[model samples]
Target: MATNLFQRFKTDISGIELPEKFTFPFYYEPHILSKIAAQELQNYLQSQTDFEHNFGLEENQKGLIIGKMFGVLVCQNKEGELGYLWAFSGKLANVNHLPYFVPTIFDMLHEDGFFRKEEEILNSINRQIEFLENSDELRTKEIQLQATKIEAATDIQNQKNKIKRLKIERDEKRNSFTNLSLSENGTSNCELVKQTLEHELSEESKRESILLKKMTKYWNFQIMNAQKEVDLFLDKINSLKEERRQKSGTLQQKLFAEYSFLNLYGERKSIGEIFDNNPPAGAGECAAPKLLHYAFNHQFKPIAMAEFWWGQSPKSEIRKHKQFYPACKSKCEPILLSHMLKGLDMYANPFQENPAEGKEIEIVYEDEILLVVNKPAEFLSVPGKIITDSVYQRVKKLYPNATGPLIVHRLDMSTSGLLLIAKNEEAYKQLQSQFIRRTIKKRYVALLDGIINKNEGVIELPLRVDLDDRPRQLVCYEHGKFAQTRWEVIAVENNKTRVHFYPITGRTHQLRVHASHELGLHTPIIGDDLYGTKSNRLHLHAECLTFMHPISKEEITIQKAAEF
Candidate 1:
C-alpha cells in the first residue's frame, strides 16, 4: 500500500512540475549556498571510483540535484550547515552503477514525502517571480517620470532665452532712434571741439618748437662763448707763465752771480767772502751772475773744466778729488751747483759752498748682511760704465773691504729712496727669495691726475705684458698672471689727488696700468708717462720697504719721504 502511494505521488508531482530540462525545489538554504562548494561536489562524483561515467549535478534552490545512474538525489544545506549527502547510482539511460552515501550516512525517505515537499518549494518560487515583475514595472515608470521632468526643464530654459533675445531686439530698436539723435548733436559739438583743440595744439606746438629752437641756439652760443673764454684763460695763464719765467731768469742770474774760476782758485779770499763786497747794481751784473750764464751755455758734466778751473790745484789735492785725466773723466763745475739747486729755494742764497764730492757717500744703514741707503732719483743702483758714477759705485767705494755687495733689487731710474743691497752672498740669496716669494712689502707715493671716488680700496686683476709693445702691460683675461694693489687717498687739491699705493705683487707697471686702463680713470701718477698724458713725467716714489733682516734675523722696516 505505501509503495503504491509513493509511486502515485511521484507520477503526480512529475506531471505537474516537470521542467523542459530540469526541476528545482524552493528552499532558502539551497539558493544561497556557495557556487564553489556545489561545483566541488560535482567534480568529486566525476572522478570517484564507484561513480558511473555519465554523471551531472545541477545547482538550484535545493542546494544541488545529483543525477547519476537512473535516479536523482536532492540535498538541502546552508553555509556551515551539516546534512546527510546521498548519492544515487542505477541504470541511467540503460546503464547501472553502485549507490553510495557521503561521510557514510544513509537516508530511507520515500518519494511520496519528497514530492510533497518539492511542490511547496515550486509554489514559493512562483510568488517571488510575481513580486520581481511588479517592482520592475514601478521602476520603469519612475525613470520615465524623471526623463519627462528633464525635458520640460530644458524647454522652459529655451523659452526664457527666446524671450530675452526678443527683449534685447526691442530695446536695440528703441535705443537706435534716441542714439541717432544724440549722435547728431554730439557730432556737431565734437567737430567744433576738435577744431578748437587742433588749433590750440597747433599754436602751442608752434610756440614750443620756436622756443626750443631759440633755447638750442642760445645754448650753442653760450657753449661757444664759454669755450672762447676758456681758451682766453689758458692763453693768459701761458702768457703769465712765460713772463714769470723771464723774470725768474733775470732773478736767478742776479742771485747766482757768475763764479770766475780764475777768481775762485787764484785769490786768497774765499768765494763766500769775495761775494760779501761790492754788490752788483743791475740784476744781470751780480758777483754770481756769471755762474747761471755759464750753466746755460754748458752741457752736462760731473767735473769742472780742468784747464780753466782745476789746473792751479796741487797734484795731491787733484788726486784727492779723483781728478785723473783718463781715469777720472767725470767733470766738476761751479755751474753744477746752480744746476743741482735748480728746484731748491737755496739757489738764490749768496753764501753756499760747492756741494762736497770728497766725503764718502753715507750708507744710511749697513750690516754684515744688508745695506740700505737713500738712493737719489738720478742715480743708478748698479755700477756700469755709462752711469757708473752712481749710488752703487759710491757704496762700493765706501765699503771696499766688503765682499760682493749684490744688488738684490732695484728702483727705477727716476724712482727715489730706500734702496736695499745685500752685503754678502747668503744675504743676497735670502732677500732674493723674499722678493720672489712676494714676502717683502713696499709702499709708494703717487700724485694722481684726478681725485678718486673711494678713500681706500683694493684692485685684484690679472696682468700680462703687451705683446705689441715691449715695455707696456695689458689686463688679460685669457692668459695672465695675477696681480694686486691697495691704495689710499691722502689729500685732494684742485681735483689732483695725492695717493699712497701698496703693491702686493712686484709686477712691472702694475699700479699705473690699473689706475689708467682698468679703472677708466686716466689717473696718471703725477708724472707717469706710459699710462699718462704725453707731457707727463715718471712721478712714482718708493717711500717704504719692510721685511725680515737678512743677517740680524729680525724684522726691519724703512721709510722715506718723496722728493717734491
Candidate 2:
C-alpha cells in the first residue's frame, strides 16, 4: 500500500535540477518538482470522482464547506527514481484513507478502535446532558421555583403590614384610656378599664407575633420544597457533564500517545512528547507531518516539499486559491523541528537573518521638540527577537539625552515610511495624543498586484493576529479590532494599480489585509509577503504626514515620495 503512494512525474523534468537541501518547512519558494506535482494533483481534484468533498468552489455548492491545505513532497526512491507524494491536512470526505494521498499517522476513526468506542460513550453522555437540560420537567420546576419565591415574599410582606396596623390601634386605645382616667368623675372606673385594656392589648400583640412567625415558616417551607425539585434535575445534568469531561481528557491523552512519528534515524516520538504533553488540536494531522512520516518509514529520501491552499478561502483567515503557504507554526513547527526533520539537511530560517543589515535611515524632518525619518524597508521600528539594530536604537544612540520612549509610532518592518520620533516626554505625549484623537493625518503610497476597477472607496474589515501563525493576520469579526482604510486609485500600468491609502485606524497589518481580503479590494499590495507573494521589497511607503508641533504650536506637514 505504501509503495503505490509514491507517484511518478507526469511531465518531462529532464531540464530541471533537484534542490541541494530539503525545504525549510517554515518558509521557502516551492521547488520546481513540488510545483509540478501540485499542479498534477490539482488536475486530478478537478476531474476525479474518487471521493466527494465540498470545497465551496461552485456558486451554489451545499453542505459545510471547508477549504483544505494540500502538500507535495519531492523524493527519490531506492531505485534512484525521482517522484513525489501527495497529502492533505486532516481527513478528507469524513475518512483518513484516500486513493493516492499519504495515510495518517494513526487511524483514530477505525470502527473497532478504542477511540471510536470511547467516542460513543462520550456521545451518550452528551445526549443525556442535552436531554436533561432541555427536559420539560426541568423547565417546569425552574419556573415553579421562581413563582413560589415571588408569591411567598408578597404574602410575608402583607402579614407584616397587618401586624404593624394592629400595633398602631393598640397604642391609640392606650392613649384614649389614659385621657379618660385624668378626668375626676370616673377615676375608679377608669383605673379598672385601664387594667383591662392593657391585658387585651398584650394578648392581641402576642397573637399577632405568633401569626407572623407562622406565616414566615409556611413560606420558607414552600420555597424549600420548590428549590429541591429544581435541584433534582440540575444535579443529574452536572454529574453527567463531569463524567464527560474526565472521559474526554483521558481519551485525548491516549489518542496523542498513539500518534508517534519516526525520523530518518528511526527515532520515534509521540505528539505529546514533542509538545510537552500539551499538543494543540490536530497537531499531528497536518499534511507536512503526514508526508514526512510516510517518507521516513518507507525509506524515501526527501528532496523538497511545498503546501498550498485550494478552493475558496475561509471566512476568518485569508487563503487565496492555489497560493503556496508555509506550514503552520503552532502545530507543525514543534513536531517537525524537534522530532520529524532531525538529521535532515534543510534551508536556513530566513527570519534568523537580520533584514535591516546595511540599510541607513534618512532624516526627513528635525526640530527641537520632535523629528521624522524616512525608514528603509525591512527595518524594524524597535528591536526584534534575533536582531537588535533598529530605527529606535539608531535614534537613541544619536540623541543619548532624549527623554521618554523615542519612537512615537511604528511602521511594518517591510514598509518604508516616515517614522516620527519625540525628544522629550511632553512632546511624546502631545504627538501620541494626536494619533489617539485621530487628529494626525497620514497618507501612504502603494502598488497593488492587480488592477482596481473602482477609483476610490473605504474598507472596514476587522483584523486580528492568526494565533496558529504569528505575524499573519486573520479577518475575524468575532475577536478582531476595527481596522479601516480609505484608498484612491492613482494610476494603472503594467496590470498593477498604484494607489494612495488614508488609514482611519492603525491596526497590525491593516492596509495589507484590507487590500488582499475578498471583502476588501481583493487586490494585494505588490510584494506584501505576508498577504501576497514575495518580491524584491514591499511597495508601500508613507508619503505624507500632518500634525501640530509641540513647542511651536504651529501645524506642520512633511512629505516624502516613494522610490518605487
Candidate 3:
C-alpha cells in the first residue's frame, strides 16, 4: 500500500518518465515528483529572467551561466491528501506570486520586529563600508609617492656609480705615472689634473649624501602621514564591520532559538540544540529542509523529495540550467539525516557491503617488512563505518602478529589498485615518511566522460567541502585548502578520453574534483558516483606506486594496469 501511494501519482508529461523513488545519499535516479517540481520552477523562472537558479552566486561576471537547485517536498496533509511544497537554495523571488510556493523558514520580509530595525542599521553600516572603500584619492596618493621614492632612489644609486667610475679612472691614471718617464725632476705631467678630479669627486659624493638624506626625509614624511590617514579610515571600517558581525551572530542565535524541528521517530529539538556542535549559518535555512521541517511539525506524512536547478550557472561552478542536483550535503544532510521520517524508503549504496569478502586478493609482492597486494575493485582498503570487512581486516586475520597501521595509503572503496601493507612499526613509520616527504610517486589511470583537448597540463584549484552537502566538494577560493593535479592524455576511445593523473597534494576527492571542475580539466571521470553520474563502478584505478623499501632502501615501483 505504501509503494502503491507513490505509484498512484503520475504526471501528463508524455515522454518523460521519472524514477519510481528518489535518489539516495550515495546512489539514485530522479523521481517524477522532482520532474514535476522542475517543470513548475522552469515555467516560473522563464517569466523572471533575473531570478537565479544558483543560490549564493550574486556577483557580476561574464560567461554562460548555469542554474542552481530548487526543491519540492511531496507530503500528505491532515486530511491524508498529497500535495507538494516548493523552495529555493537561498531565498525566493516574490513570495506573493502565483503558483503559490512554500513559505521560507523565516519571514525575512516582515516589516515589524527586531529583524527590520536591526537589519536597517546593518544595511546602513554596509553602505558606509562601501563608500569608504570606494574613496580612492588617498590610496592613489600613496601609490604616486611610492613611485617617486623608487625614482629618487634610482637616481641616487646612479650618481654614486658614476663617482665610483671616476675614482677607478683616477687610480688608473696614478698607476700610469709610476710607469711613465719623469719630466725634469721625475714628476708626472698634469699633476693638477689629478687634484682637480679628486676635488670634483669629493664634491659629488657630498652632494649625493645630502640629496639622499633630503629625499629620504621628504618621502618618509609624506608617506607616513598618508599611511596614518588611511589607517584611521580603515580602523573605522573595521570597527563597523565588527559591530555588524556581533549583531548578525546575535540575530542568528535568536532565530535558531525560536525555530524547532521534528523527526519521523517523534523526536524533536529546537534548531539551537540540533546545532549545538557548530553554530548554524546556512543549515536548515534551505528550501527543501525548511519545507520538510514544516510538514513534519504540522503532522504531515512525507512521501517524496526532489530538487532542480532553474537559473544560469554560476561562473565559478559548472551548473547547467534545468539540471537536477540532489539536496546539498553541506547545509541539509545532518538536518535531513536526523529528521527524515522513518517510513520513507532510503536509497542504498552498493559499496556499503564487502563486495570482495569471499573474493581472492592477489599478492603482487611480499617480504618480512611489508606486503604489496593488488586491491580489487569494490573492496575497501580500510574498514568503514558500515563495512567492517576490508583489506586491513583481511591482512590482520592472516598476520595476527603484524604491528603498526597496516595500510600505508588508502584507496577509495570503488577503486582497485596496489596497496602497501607494513608488517611492523618501523616499516609503517618508514613508508608513511616517504608519503609525508613526498618521496613516493603515485599514478592513477582513469577514463573520463568527455574528450579533453589539451595533451598535458597542471590543474591548481583550491577545494573545500560544500557545507550544505556532505561528501560533495566545491571549488572554493576562500576557506579552501590547496590541491593540485597534473594530467596527460593517454588516449581517446569511443568518444571518451583517458588520462594519467599525477596528484601533487592529497585532498579528499582531489582527483575527482580537479577532473570535473570547470576550472580544472573540465572532464568528469566516467562513472564517478559523487561528481558525475553513477555507473557499475568508478572508472579510476591507482595503477602505479613507487616507494622505498624500509630495510633494503631500494626504490620499488609496482604497476597494476586497469582492466577496462
Rank the models by TM-score, top first. Answer: 2, 3, 1
Give one digit per residue, the lDDT tens place, for model 2 in 460-557: 99998998889899998899999999999999999999999999999998999999999999999988877888789999999999999987889999
Total clashing pairs in model 3: 20
lDDT of 1 at 468: 30
Q: Model 1 over residues 30-72: C-alpha lDDT tens digits?
A: 2111222233344445466653332223223232222221111
lDDT of predicted model 2: 0.92
Q: Which portions of model 1 show Cα errors greater than 4 Å?
A: 1-362, 383-390, 534-537
Cand. 2 TM to true fold? 0.91
Candidate 1 C-alpha error for residue 265, in Å:
50
Best by TM-score: 2
Better of 2 and 3 by lDDT: 2
The lDDT of model 3 is: 0.71
Please list the C-alpha lDDT of all candidates, in the order they appear: 0.47, 0.92, 0.71
TM-score of 1: 0.34
